[model samples]
Target: MQNGRKQIAVWDVFVRLFHWCLLAAVLISFYTTKTDGAPFLFPIEVHAQAGYIIIGLLIFRVIWGVLGPTYARFSTFVYGPKNTASYAKALLKRQEPRYASHNPLGGWMVVLLLLSLSFQAVSGLFLSDDIFFQGPLYGLLGRDVSGELASLHALNSDLLLILIGIHLVGIVVHALLGEHLVPAMVTGIKRFTSAPVDEKPAYRTKYRLLAIGAFLVAAGVCGWLWFYPY
Candidate 1:
């Protein structure tokens, strides 16, 4: 603790690692799918692999949101509609209260982003380019249905870009409001200017093994789903 503030461990190692890995996977997926050629000698298969990675990460996150530490739990950040609206109003007035994890509006944004990504990844599994490339589960769904899902996947990709832009803007706003959110995510420590006297976040980084186990289980499921049809 320093400068009239206290530092609390908020994001755990698994959360931070998952966040950055997901970002990397998303970037790879976007580049491979959106461009004619990928950098770093990456092949088109990287796109599907990245989607698989995103699915695995999302699955692990869902489990972690239920069983992780206090600050990492969904209950800590996902607020009700009334509380979300109140937070939104305060945010517009630039007087929203500080939160150790995501703010109310940001929490909902996270949910939307997750849902969008899940759709994109799942739909891509049924896509076919009619060329050298075909998704793993392409034959499972008939051509007409898979073709329709491919179109929706492209549209959702655009929506994801919009959501990502808004997230970046929110990061900028947080920086202007004197909150270094990125660093906290990277370091797993959030500094509070004036923490509640009666309440302190409980440290629970000891669950690192549990986090790993969750990710392994998620990965195993995704692996079977990806390769079982082959």
Candidate 2:
């Protein structure tokens, strides 16, 4: 606390790393998938690799959401439907309460984004272009089933684009309200004019070891997925 402002840690290192990595994976996957033979586009192998990485990132995130720091834990941010609806109403009036962690609406958005990405990644595992590229699980399922999953995968990708657009719009809205949402995410620090003098202490533990272990497990899973076809 200094000069009538208190700096609080809102995102830990793992959370920040996960956020940017997932964003890059999603963007790379999108570009590769959409630009099949176009100039300056990555090969389909890159797209498939990105999808595998997304699977690992999602797995690590689900685990971390349970065992991570104060603001990173799912229990600290997820709210009930009633509370979410109330927050939505407040947003319409531009009077929503400022939260140290994710606001209620943003919490739900996070859940939706994670779920959407998970669906896309899983479905991609069984997809096939029938010409040059095929997913790792493409042979396990019959052609018809794989085709259906591929259709769903393409549809979900469109939904993901729409969701991303909405997320950007929300960022703009927050910016208009004088909240530096993007910067806070990048720096992991949120400054408050007057923080609680005796707020509950952060949950401290050997988080570095835990993060390393989780990352190793995720990487191992991804490696298995990548090489299982060979």
Q: Give the number of the best model, judged by lDDT.
A: 1
Model 2 residue 229 lDDT? 55
* Model 2 local distance difference test score: 0.84
Model 2 RMSD in angstroms: 2.3
| lDDT of every predicted structure (CA atoms) | 0.84, 0.84
Query: Residue-wise lDDT of candidate 2 within 1-230, one digit each (tens)?
Result: 87878778788878999999999999888988677635534467788889999999998998889887778888878899998899899889987777788888888889999999999998888887777677888868899888888888889999999999989998899888867788988998777776532233554657888888889989998898888753
Query: Per-residue lDDT tens digits of candidate 1, residues 160-190?
Result: 9999999999999989998898999899888
> For every candidate structure, what is the RMSD over all alpha carbons to the true structure, in angstroms?
2.1, 2.3
The TM-score values for the models, in the order shown, are 0.92, 0.92
Which regions of candidate 2 deviate over 4 angstroms? 36-42, 196-200, 203-205
